[model samples]
Target: MQIDAHQHYWDPARGDYGWLTPDLAALYRRFGPADLAPLRERAGIARTVVVQAAPTVDETRYLLGLARDDDSIAGVVGWVPLLDREAPALIAELARDAKFKGVRPMLQDLPDDDWIANPALAPAIEALIAHELAFDALVFARHIDALQSFASRYPSLRIVVDHGAKPPIVEGPAGWQPWADRIAKLARLPHVHCKLSGLATEAAPRWTEATLRPYVDHLLASFGPDRLMWGSDWPVLNLNGDYLLWHSIATTLLDVLTDAQRDAIFGGNAAAFYRLEV
Candidate 1:
């Protein structure tokens, strides 16, 4: 049961996607299950975790609604206002749905790197722990220190670092510093996991397998296969490369691992991390 750990389905008209503007013509329109169906089929992907593209409860609910009808969707990682006083109730409400697996706070867009570690978010964080829902940290290299502190503070909340903390692939080897070092520090936490996705879009426009190999090697060495998982980051991934191309590249990059290790990164780890039924 292969699972694409992270992906998204959104409509630009939804008004909640503040980041989706017309200038980014490649991904300014609507993208739904039907559009991903053929690609998933071709990649032999049986399930996917559709993550939140917008930071609204309405958009979360919209994705949940879509999940209700799409069996191919293994889980939905939606957004919730963690700082709001009413967040715990809202999280509890969302937790009622079997497909609502987790929440992402969109930390990457926030100005403060330490925003996620704020004490005021305790209530919502407690709710997530109580409900056994995961926390998807959509962060960059700069946020790793705060993320590490937060993970240490909680210790029990399941957290997955999206995009391997989104290393600066465009800068080549010169970009390796802080990101690689910080990611290694964060990986020391057993409860923390990471997604091997979004690197293609992070690289130069004409990225190749060789261009991304170093970062991939670092992640594999830091987290190992059991704590790492594969994700497409599709639709958004279309900006730099297609689903098949990324899949092919990931396949080639991970080909050196044993079959069991390869299987864990491609599917087993995500299933266990997300607690998916499959």
Candidate 2:
């Protein structure tokens, strides 16, 4: 069963996505199972993990509600006020739903790059560990060092670095080395996982298989297929390419690997990390 492990659905009228503004024309409209159905079908992605696009519990609940009705959504990586004193209680409340797989705090949008390292948020991380839910680190390279320390502090927390820590793809070869080095360090933590997603959007109009190959190569070598997973990051991915195109590019990158390795990166690893029933 193929899984596109990190995609999102949103409506503009909700007013929760402070980032989903009119400037992002490609993603300014509503996207739902209907919008994604054709893409997933074309890509042969049987299931998906609907991740949060807004940093609101209302949006999280909206995604979870969709997951409850839509079998195509295997689970959801929703959001919570991770630093709030009530975070553990909120996590416990969300955990009651079988489809609630994890939490992401929109770290990339935060003003403080070291926000994840705040001691006040320790209870929320512990709650995720206790509940067997994952932590999707929506971080950029600027947050890598703190992320490494944070991941080390909670050795048992199932943390997955979204978008290979969203490397500086626009900077080309000069950008790949530092992010790759940090990825290697993060991979050393047995509990940490990496996602081969969002690179297309990062590369934008100039994206090509060649432009992304080196980064893909680094991730494959550093995490190996066993510790990595594939995600479409759709809707937002429309900013650069579509789901089928990303799938084709990913396939081309993984063509060198053995079938089992490809299988793990594309589906098995995500299933294991999210503990999806499929």
RMSD of each: 0.6, 1.0
Name the runs in model 1 displaced over 4 angstroms. none
| TM-score for each candidate, following the candidate numbering | 0.99, 0.98
Clashes of each: 0, 0
Q: Over the full model, what C-alpha lDDT does candidate 1 score relative to the true structure?
A: 0.95
- lDDT, candidate 2, equals 0.91
Stretch of 10 with least lDDT, candidate 1: 109-118
- Each model's lDDT comes to 0.95, 0.91
Off by over 4 Å in 2: none
Model 2 lowest lDDT segment of ten: 171-180
Residue-level lDDT tens digits of model 2 in 97-177: 999999998899999999888999899999999999999999988788999999989998899999989988888777777
